[model samples]
Target: MSKVTILGGSGAVGSIATETLASSGVFSEITVADINFAAARKLVGKLKGAKLSVAELDAENPHSIRRAIGGSAVVLNCVGPFYKHGPTIMKAVIEAGINYVDVCDDFDATEKLLAMDDKAKKAGVSALIGMGSSPGVANVLVRFCADSLLDQVEAVDIYHAHGGEKIEGAAVVKHRIHSMKVDIPMFLDGKFTTVNLFEDSGKALEEETEFKDVGTYSVYGYPHPETITLPKYLKGVKRVTNLGLVLPPAYAELIKGMVRLDITDEKPIEVQGHKVIPLEFAVAYILSQREKLMKEAGINQPMGCLKIVVKGYKDGGKNTYIFSMSSRGQGMGEGTGIPAAIGAILMGTGKITEKGVLPPEACVNPMDLL
Candidate 1:
């Protein structure tokens, strides 16, 4: 039977991916695998299509990941803080000799996975990375502009703002924190460079923009992989930048506050003879105030937009095109999760012919995905 195993299948994006993949009819059986087996079972129980089952998986253990996806036709990884598990899980997929897809937006992780191109080729498996919103769809859009819209693509700017998911999992929050704490990549003057989110390097590129359907908000440099991967494919592109936000200004400020207070340290500390990770505590504090901030921002529904601005010379004349994808009444789940499912579908159906680890823009045809 054709089966697809989804890691972290009980979490926010995982749950949505499970539902979408099951509905595709591409697989005869769909396994919802997560560290929490009961939660996985709970998610599968709600689905009436595609035979669903649950499996316990510890993503930290390569053996566990391999075993969970051992016999699946395709493995879709929805586990996040992609920096933490992205490369490890992709390694397991290749070792298992199975096709794979993942929503990995972390620039560093994307580089690590791309470096494994030789390994994946030896295993004879197709692995698609950065298949989420920003890195996934965003990458495809830029490719479209380069291949179809312009003869010479000079610059590409990606902007995103999404929020009102109601509740967020720890992995999502942790990923956001890690994004801010690390050095983000951007293609500048046809060269690659890094910038810290809180430093002048990142702040200088910051700007306020309006998203279709979503209100205008401040966006900062995001460490999404598109900035690094696009330039490799879109030649002569002088610049590629990814700037995004989670919405509700105060929530972003709360995270900024934690960064300023030196409270984002990941090291465990003894608090009154109890152990606590400062970053963990900060995540909790931010969650406590997220609702209030959203209310004040007047954003109560799921709203998000992926806006791409491309500029270059066409027929020896300056030209530009602005392509924007806005989602209403849907947040990360529909935006990110759906594309992850589509990528998995494409892989499972043998539509993706590439035989090694590759980013969306590198192997995937933009118009086909669009």
Candidate 2:
């Protein structure tokens, strides 16, 4: 019987992943582990066929994580902001000798996880990272292009955005803000360049890239793992860029305000004689206003779009193929969690036969995932 455990299994993404994987009738048992035991249990209550169990897991504690993942064939980590819990959970998975996959979007944390490739390989465990929609599907599509559609690929552009209620945790919000504040790495002009999320890096790009159904929006450069990992996988690729935006000008404005104010800083300051971090306050304020923002934007139904463009030579001629997927109603949870669950299932079944820390593009078969 194949057993799978999902850390942060009660959260939005984890819940969808749990449902998706369990319904596939692949895992003999599915364990939902989270800091909130009640929430995990609630999620498990809705699942059937697969034996469901709930457990308490503090992702920050290696011993706790190891105990939670014991006897499981695979561990799907949906915890975030991955920058904090990613390494710890990954280490625990390695020590427990279990295959691991996660939807982590933090580039720095991913870099650290990649450093564990040798360790994971030595342990004979496959650790696939960034198996979410943008990083996950986007990477796989790029590989598909390079492998079959493109020869000597020259440039790759990935665009992603979510529209609707931003149902995300405080840590995720802070990470998004942090990403905007920092300079992220990207390949440009046949070389690696550091670019800020909203800053123009003196590079000229086409006005817009058309997404199948969704109207085109101005895409600002954002540092996602694809920009850094694609080069290593796809040789002769000169430029790789990731652009992301949120729907509703108001939400964008809110994020812009936080970035401009540097409210993402972690250091705490005295607020009315109480020590508080500005980022924490900002997250709290934004979360409190979530319902209001949704109402104002009239976004009861959530939607997202991911488009990948690969340009180069194929079949002895210049060819460009655009792989695009758009979804609605499930929001980011389904959009991100489904692929993550698929990654876990693949690892559990030995389909991803490689033993190393790898990005989704390196491990997944695009057609299979799609």
Candidate 3:
């Protein structure tokens, strides 16, 4: 009878994770903790056959996180904009002596969490960071190839994209813009290299990747955790790159426009005798346009793919292995939440036996997870 606590459990990914884990019947109790307690309560009402509770949790505040995770065996964090809430909540989880898992996609946050490995190990708590689709499954695929399919891994390419629904969260949009602005890191020429988003520095390995049901679209490099973590984990891996694209040319244009305008800045600017942040304004504008984009694309539901290509050695010779997972409807929820919930279940069951900060591939067995 393990008790699980989920921070930000009222949100889209969190709600789906809550239901998914409850339906698994592996946990004794599932607590949905969010800043908005009412939302948590509403979600709890819909779950059955599990002991559920709702709690107010401000993930940005250490004290609130400490209070929310009390008496819980494991914590699944679905809070967004990891750059803001990641460190605080992680600290609280470690201090409480509980295993932790999160679906963070931000590279900066992942790097920061990596720095906390010693602390987590000292606390005797296992921390699985970036357990969501792209970083999660993508990393596991690389490990599977390196360990089972490849002898001398030369290069790895990871691609992920979503289509059908225009996500309406300003925070998510702002996070995307922020990712675009930062210099993305990749492993190149047997060394680590940094390139701007859409930059033409990294060597291009043309891949004719096919998703299960979604049609193929060209994928270009995007800075994701796989770019940074794979090299460290996969020996002889010379080049590692990650790419992502959104469906419909119009949405791509919109994101490019937002990036070009430098609207993702967080610094406050004075406008009409008032203070405003450009990033905040950009988020609002993006949210307003989501419905129109979805309607124009005739996307009432979402579908996407996370594909990984590993080129190296098999049976002591050159070979290539492609691993892909295609998901439909509830793009963010299913794609992200399912993996997060599975990570939580694994942590609770001691399937993930590592006691340090780690990415999914470093800590999980791909075959077991699949």
- The number of the candidate with the highest lDDT is 1
lDDT order, best first, reads: 1, 2, 3
Error of 3 at 150 (Å): 2.1
- How do the predictions measure up, each by TM-score? 0.97, 0.95, 0.95
lDDT of 2 by residue, 145-194 (tens): 88877778989988887777446777667767767777777898678888
Q: What lDDT tens digits, residue by residue, belong to model 3 across residues 254-347? A: 8768887887688999999999998888778876777678679776788888888889977778898887788776576778888999999888
lDDT of 2 at 281: 86
Evaluation by lDDT, superior candidate among 1 and 2: 1
Model 2 residue 26 CA deviation (Å) reads 1.0
- lDDT at 188, model 2: 86
Q: Which residue pairs clash within candidate 3?
A: none
The best-first sequence of candidates by TM-score reads 1, 2, 3
lDDT comparing candidate 3 with the true structure: 0.82
Q: Which regions of candidate 1 are displaced past 4 Å? A: none
TM-score, cand. 1: 0.97
